[model samples]
Target: MNGKRGMHYVGWKTLCKTKASGGLNFHSAVSRSGPLKARLSWRFLQNKDSLLYQVISAKYGNNLWDATNRRGSSIVSKILLEGAQ
Candidate 1:
């Protein structure tokens, strides 16, 4: 569809609009929700890694070698497995 004419179709117009209207984009008035979601997801991943590190150290002691890289690798592997599905 052409740039200006893309929104002409009721279906196309609705798809380019907001989630409340069944589109992928968030409401224009509260667009910060998208950025907020990214920030929160980043923070949650960091928190998960931190928590995993703490648990590994507490259970396995300082011998939990290469903890940060290992944790990241595990997450990557898990994602890869899921993606393969």
Candidate 2:
């Protein structure tokens, strides 16, 4: 809809902003996914005794905070660490 012929009345960034900020209140994919990823990371951090967490910890070790060496870390672990940060 950024095309000239289309109804490109507002910019994408503006359209993605919240109505409280004087925009349409639509959420961009990045903004929406960010919170969900963060929530997943938080859950992983808080639910250490959970089965899923235990499995992950067993595979990757329980050192979630020290990700300096990500050589053998799983993709999910990396994503959770980055999202938490």
RMSD (Å) of each candidate, 1 decimal = 11.2, 4.8
Model 1: per-residue lDDT, tens digit, 7-72? 444555566677776787634534464465555445534675676445544654644333344555
Where does candidate 1 have its weakest 10-residue lDDT segment? 76-85
Candidates' C-alpha lDDT: 0.49, 0.79
TM-score of each: 0.24, 0.56
Per-model tally of clashing residue pairs:
0, 0
Measured by TM-score, the strongest candidate is 2
| Pairs that collide, model 1 | none
**Which parts of model 2 are misplaced by more than 4 Å?**
1-26
Candidate 1 segments exceeding 4 Å error: 1-29, 49-85
lDDT of 1 at 85: 33
Q: Please provide, for model 2 over 1-85, each residue's C-alpha lDDT reduced to its tens digit, 9 standing for 90 to 100.
A: 5565755578888987788887897768876777787998889889978886887788768676676586877778777877787
